[model samples]
Target: MMLPTRLQGSLNNELNDGETILWLDQPIASRMARGAWPIVLFGIFWSTFCAGWMFFTINMAMKTPADQAGLFAWLFPAFGLPFCIIGLGMLTSPIWVRRLALRTVYVLTDQRAMIISRSFGKTHVRNYTPEKLNDINRSLNDDGSGDLIFEKVISSHTHTHRNTHSLGHGGHRAGGGRSSRTRTSTTTYGFKCIKQAKQVHELIDGMVLASKPVAEQD
Candidate 1:
């Protein structure tokens, strides 16, 4: 298939001399942003804390007598300035992600699958070659549009540990049971929320299978 008109210039530089583009399309921006609320909520919580800290600190500084106020009073309030800015960035990230979805393109070629993204004023091309097509998963929706996951990157998570201790004859010799919970996050790379996801998945599977050595297929 031919590359979209808008994407041609951005992608031509990245394509191989003889590479065949089998499919090309942009993700549904709304779908790309479906997972945004969690992050926004977390951002709100984070910013609230930071903002609260700064407010209270500054209020205290203002109440202090001019001659009695020390350098630490004003300095401590400034510490939260950067953190609050970071929190605000997070709070607005979902909107930014949605906008980026408009600029993002997903392509599948005989040689590879690619996600061409424009982020922070730079173009990023993420490729998954036929050799790396060991695992391909899909999530379908009733509307006949869904996601085809080619890559999953789990960035690491915050883990909370809780321990329950029972005192035996001696506290030093007591046995303890541990319980832990974690808030894990994963970044999925795919042709997200596109039409005919099943067909695209099957087509890519076929292409990958055809690329494999006969012995490997057997």
Candidate 2:
């Protein structure tokens, strides 16, 4: 599908010489509705509870005399502030995600796949070359819109540290402590919530095959 004029203009300026656009599209709005009900419910519960706590704390603080209020009265409102803000943010996250989709564009080119996103007054672009891609997967929604995960990169790190503590026994001291921590993170890249994801996936696969050298094709 042809992109809108404004979107096309922005993409055109970013294209490399002789690179051709094969497919381009934005995410569907209903994408937000998929697997979002649980989050929405949690947000509602969290925000309602936090707001009530905030109001109650503020009212109690106001009713307490300044001299008697002390640190406890002041601390209550301070404690409630972060939770209130976080809850409100959670409640509004779905709306934010949907709005973000409006400014996001996905492009498939002969040489690479590109994602253009404009958020918080910043424009960011991500490009993935076919040769560098790994573990391509797809998840389709009932309505034929889905996500194409072209790469899954898993990174792991482990750290070990020793601590010494003094143990006094008959004028002798001994100490030893060892701790280890491991962290794993997985990052997936590709078109998210695009229509005709299977078709797009197949098209990209064909492009990748065609881009291979003649000797590699055999």
Best by TM-score: 1
Error of 1 at 101 (Å): 1.0
Query: TM-score for model 2?
Result: 0.77
The C-alpha local distance difference test score for the whole of candidate 1 amounts to 0.83
Name the top lDDT candidate. Answer: 1
Q: Return the lDDT, model 2, position 86.
A: 81
For each candidate, the alpha-carbon lDDT, in order, equals 0.83, 0.81
Cα deviation at 145, candidate 2, in Å, is 2.5
| TM-score of each prediction | 0.78, 0.77
Scored by lDDT, model 2 comes in at 0.81
Alpha-carbon shift of residue 91 in model 1 (angstroms): 1.7
* Lowest lDDT 10-residue stretch of candidate 2: 29-38
Per-candidate count of clashing residue pairs (backbone under 3 Å)? 0, 0
Per-residue lDDT, model 1, residue 128, is 91
